[model samples]
Target: MNQLGSIIFLIAIFLFSTFLNWYVFQAVKTLTFGLEGERMKQIVAVSYWLIFGGISIWLVITFLRIFQMGEINVQTQTALNVFLTVMVTQLVCVVFLFGEDIVRNVQAGVTYLVNGSNGFSFPERMRWVSGIALVVAMIPFSSFIYGVTKGKHNFKVHREIIYFDDLPDAFDGFTITQISDIHSGSFTNYDAVQKGIDLAIDQKSDLFVFTGDLVNHKAEEIDPMLDQFKKIKAPYGQFSILGNHDYGDYVSWSTKEAKEANFLKLKNQHKKLGYRLLLDENVVIEKDGQTIQLLGVENWGLGFKAKGDLEKALANTAASDFKILLSHDPSHWDEEVKKNMNKVHLTLSGHTHGMQFGIETPIIRWSPVQYRYPNWAGLAEENGRYLYVNRGFGFHAFSGRVGIWPEITVIELRKTVSSME
Candidate 1:
């Protein structure tokens, strides 16, 4: 964006933040009314101003950095994350305050209508309403804190057994572990990241697959985590495919050559991690007198780079073979994989990351990303074909995961017997 556009956007944020500050201040003032010795009042006042003031200062610093450095660096990205989460907490407080006002206004209107006098007094703000707001707002506030401190590293291993009637006999009970969207550029805690990798290694699955997005926009970002991720070994092999971020499309490079060079380095990093990087290619995993095709394509989706050629990737394979596809974006499955002439029995993806936040339980699974990508988060089947979208092993711009923790998926393939047999 131009300098003028940046300034306008910052100004808009300032105005909204200021309005939220006023509501929060008013709420605090009412809550501390007649409290013991004004000590509690002073404490709440100082805490609120300190946090809000810090946010304002951070906004100014990030705005200046954008003009001076021309883009958001790591520091600026972190500051922006803090600003957004705190602002969300303020918004929640505003909603509760508005509800309190509605209640007060309704009571005053009833009094005025019945008495029909100008002397009818406006109802005082409900003291308990402030307490309620504090309790309610704490929900998101604490959640953001936990997400940053722990949720990002809280990797959960999801295991599932899927049965196929046309399965190869030798591949029955074959296990695969998949992780995606590493976004190495966003990592801050090294030991925590290694812990997640170790958990995946502990699964000891037959095959390991990293669906996409090894870094944010630069190849060098994964340099530090290479050794840690290299330890994730499987018996069959470890394979990977590129996501949109691996192409360096989001950053400004000096020249086309430099971007191409960076992309090459990212592809090499996959090899360094002991993974066979697949770019619109196919590999046959052979076992006890049988074979299954594992086809991988480059980043191809509705809004992303359309470099992947599904037909080309499946060239050497036959339609009757049991085929599994490793695609970066779930939209690729929605748009191409399922509808292609060659049937892909299963497809794996991880682009949405479940928005890194959502509630998923046995009874219900919901995330904001569902509105955008119908095949988001977990398993979804269409026309006997299956797609499983991993929640992601790492985070990006948001810096945390709320309800949806980082995920590692372990899948077991089973052969189904025919009912007639």
Candidate 2:
């Protein structure tokens, strides 16, 4: 964005954040109003402002550094994470506090209307209401803290068995393990990341695919953990495709040639890890004299990059053949993949990371990202086509995974008995 637009955006964010802080501060004052001593009240007030002001200043400095230098260090990322966690906690407290104020004012107004203004007084803030607000706010605050400390590396293996009527007989019961969004630059704990890689290795799937975002903005990010990821090998082969971030588009470079060189280096990293990096291309995996097509396209999504050529990727492939597509963003499946004339039996993607935060249980699955991408996580099917979106292998901007932990997806493709008959 231009300089003036950026300034306006920053001002808007500052005003909104200021409003939230003021609202939460009022609740804090109400909660401590009945304290025993003047000194105690002074202490409480000072502590609250000190903590909030410190985080706010840190965030402002971090953002300014990012704007000027086009870089974010580990310390800056940590500050951003802390600011988001605290802001979310304060928002929860503000909800309850606002409700209490509305009810109290309404009651006071009714009393004044019924009686006269003589010796009338507004209702004092209730300690019980403020107490409840503070207590409830702890739930999210604690959850966010744990998410940063542990949840990012807490990988969960999700398994799905999809039955396809047109699947080749030889490939029946074939398992493909998929992992996406490795975001290697954000990793801080090497041992924890190694454990996640070991879990994927244990799955023992026939084929393995990495759907993208191997690095955050540069290829060198994967240098430290290259060996760990190389351990994920399957019997058939390991394949990969790029995500939007792989092109180094997020960072500002000194020259166009520098960016292109970085992109070339990233592709070479995939080969170093023993993966066949597919760039709008197809390769056939053969078993028992029968072949199934595996097509991979570049990063293509509705709002993001559109480098993937679906038609070119499907070139020379028949409609009747069993085909599996590897695209990074799930929107490709929703917008183009499923609707293509040359049908793809299955499409694997992983870009949302389920927003790295949301509630998912046996009963309800909900994330804010769902509003943006209909097929945000897990499996979604339409007619005979299937799409499985891996939650992600790592975290990004937020530096944490709350309820939506990092994921390794294992999919077993089965051919239906009816199709054989």
Candidate 3:
């Protein structure tokens, strides 16, 4: 953005933060009215300014970096995310306090109008409302703090059993461990990341697949941690496909050759990590004289790069073959895979990363990403075709995973029995 645009954006942020801070201060004062000395008051004052001021500084730095380099660095982005989370949580608290103010004001207004000036009495602020608002806000505040400090690498194994009548007999009990959107560029701890890889290896799944986004936008980002990820192995082999970030579309390049070189290096990085980087191609895996097709495509989505050619990948493949496709974006399945002439038994994807934040429970699952992509996370089926959207193995801009913990997906393919048929 130009200087004028940047300045206007920053001003808007400042004004919003100012208003939010005012509401927060009122809530805090009301809650702490008869409590301890000015100590609590001073602390709240310092904290509010420290957070908002730090955010403003971070925003300025971010825009400066963008102006200079045409992109924000990962560290700055992470810092911004932290501040933004805190800001949002504070806003949530203020909203409740604001609601309380409205109710109290309405009650006071009614008393004045009903009794007239002679009998009218001013209503006192209810401290309990502010207290409750604070308590409620602290829940998310604490959750986000935990998410940033530790939950990013809290790898959870999601075990799923999928049954298919047409599944090849040899692959009936086959297990596939999948991880997606590694985004190594955003990773800071090798040992923590290694723990996740170890967990995947421990599953000893027959096959391993990385759906996409091995790095944020550059191949070199994975250089430091290549050895750590290389430890992940499966009996069938490790296969990977590029995600949107793997193409270096977000960063500025000096020349076309430089961009091409970066892409080549990313492809080579997959090879270095011992992954068969499939580009719109199919590989047949045989077990006990029976075969299943593993088809992979480049990142394809409704609005993303349409590099994946399903027809080219499925070329020469039998229609009756049990096919498992590795696609980066779940939208690919929503838009094309399900509608394809040939049946794709299962499709694996990992582009959403569940927005790195959301609530997921047995009773209900929700994420902001759902608004954009219907198949945002977990498993969904339509027309007998299955799509498993991995929550992602690593975080991106937020540098944290809240309720949607990073996942190592273990899928067991079961063949439908004759009795069931």
Candidate 4:
């Protein structure tokens, strides 16, 4: 479905939540405000109210994701920032205004009942009802359409080093260009895709890595951009891994063999494009008169992602070598690489894509996925280990980004210095 259609479905959820909350609210009010079993009513009422609204909102958001649009350029996002700013600001203001009145009415309802019981006047009840009316009037503003696409191809040289103490000294100063979640099915237009690939090529990094989800579902989704992806080059080589979406898990197919064939075809296609497909295996990049083991594990994640064995892939290795692991999901860095396999020092991952949406500001930066993981965006460090989550080279199901634009990340690896504190 299209973005507008998915948004309409969310509106349906909003309506359902409204009805459920109202029905439950009325039932509770009657029990509490009258001579009835108020305690039982409170339990059931609270359950219905919270569950209905929360679940509905979640479902609506998830469903609306099917409309993921093409990414816009950074220039475009900045150009439209002024107008989008006004729209988002005014819309949020209106939503909050009604939200305030809703709170006032609830408080007033309790106030009126308490006063009436104590022999005071009932005049305040009308005010409570009027406040409720105002709250109801503000729902449309809360449903405003935000400027979702923050755009993709803005190039600023970020001279940052993503380092790890355990990194092999031989591989220090290694620069790499990484792409993940291209999802070309949703990437609309030749110009945008070309621009994104051009940015990656312009980095001129030693090695290039593609983490996964190259297409949304089938192989055909990416055929249009095959030549563009082949253009990405590095002195060392290019490597890739599979993402959960690449397995054709989300769609219904004629047969399992056909789906498997499609995935294998994609793997072969990667080979045709001069990328080494890493399927639960490892590759050694010989550079700078030394070799560093590049261990590429299959798809794996903490909760939502599929599991692929990283240990089996690294079984032949010595713990002392400088190692860089390419695992699709960043959550793997926290759950597995950080502890169970501490030997894997520098890990590169991209399943999160910062959840494809994050706050784009200097102060108090954040993304919605922040609720899911502590180290949710940009570069993350813990326990002398390093994980860099790419924002992504392509767009996905949401069709547009608000603050978080689609990204092309260039990372330079530096060796740990010898100076003492």
Winner by TM-score: 2
- Candidate 1 on 1-421: residue-level lDDT in tens? 6779888888887777777888888878897787887788899888988888778777877877756654455787777678767877888888989987898899989999998777899888777888788788888888888887788899999888888988899999999999999999989899999889989999999999999999988999999999899999998999999999999987878889998999999989998999999899999998898999999999998888989999889998888999999999999999999998889999999989899877888898888888999988888888889899999999887888889989999999999988888
Best first by lDDT, ranked:
2, 1, 3, 4
Residue 65 in model 1: lDDT: 77
Model 3 Cα lDDT, one tens digit per residue, 77-170: 7766766676768888988887877888898899888887886776766788888888888888888888888999999999999999898788
The Cα local distance difference test for each model comes to 0.88, 0.91, 0.88, 0.67
Q: What's the TM-score of each model vs. the native?
A: 0.91, 0.97, 0.91, 0.71
Candidate 1, run of 10 with poorest lDDT:
65-74
| Model 2 residue 101 lDDT score | 84
The weakest ten consecutive residues by lDDT in model 3 span 64-73
The window of 10 residues in a row where model 4 has the poorest summed lDDT is 140-149
Model 4, 167: alpha-carbon shift in Å?
4.3
Comparing 3 with 4 on lDDT, the higher-scoring candidate is: 3
Better candidate by TM-score, 1 or 4: 1
